[model samples]
Target: MNSALQKSSSIFRTAAMQVRHTSVTRYIGTPPQVRISTAEKCAHIAVIVGTILAGPAWVLVHLQDYKK
Candidate 1:
């Protein structure tokens, strides 16, 4: 925190002087390139499929009970 408060210009008076380069590389890898393992992929697929099935079943059950 002390280092951050200090001005970069105060440390190096010369404009031409090359300060240390801070690399912007992510500590964690980029998202799209990240791989999902086989079991994880299956689990995700199961949730989507379950939602699809459950939604219709839920509607049917409620429609029976709450008929106009």
Candidate 2:
């Protein structure tokens, strides 16, 4: 029974060590490259426009409530 417990604990420890090493290796690996293409730029502009439009749209939609 004691040897069985030791073997299970050893396996668990080994798995944990492997996970740690794999995570560390992944972090150390080359990161994905980024390309700032025209499409990406357009998408960013759309996001910014949407974000900016949301505020004014919200204000316009709720403008009547503020008058009271």
> Residue by residue across 7-65, what tens digits does model 2's lDDT show?
99999999999999998885646664976889989999999999989999999999999
Where does the lowest 10-residue lDDT sum fall in candidate 2? 26-35
> lDDT of candidate 1?
0.72
TM per candidate comes to 0.40, 0.41
- Model 2 off-target regions past 4 Å? 29-68
**Candidate achieving the largest lDDT:** 2
Tens digits of lDDT, candidate 1, 1-68: 66754666555644434332333332556577868899999999999999889988898989968787
Clashes of each: 0, 0
TM-score quality measure for candidate 2: 0.41
User: What C-alpha root-mean-square deviation, in Å, does candidate 2 show against the real structure?
Assistant: 5.7
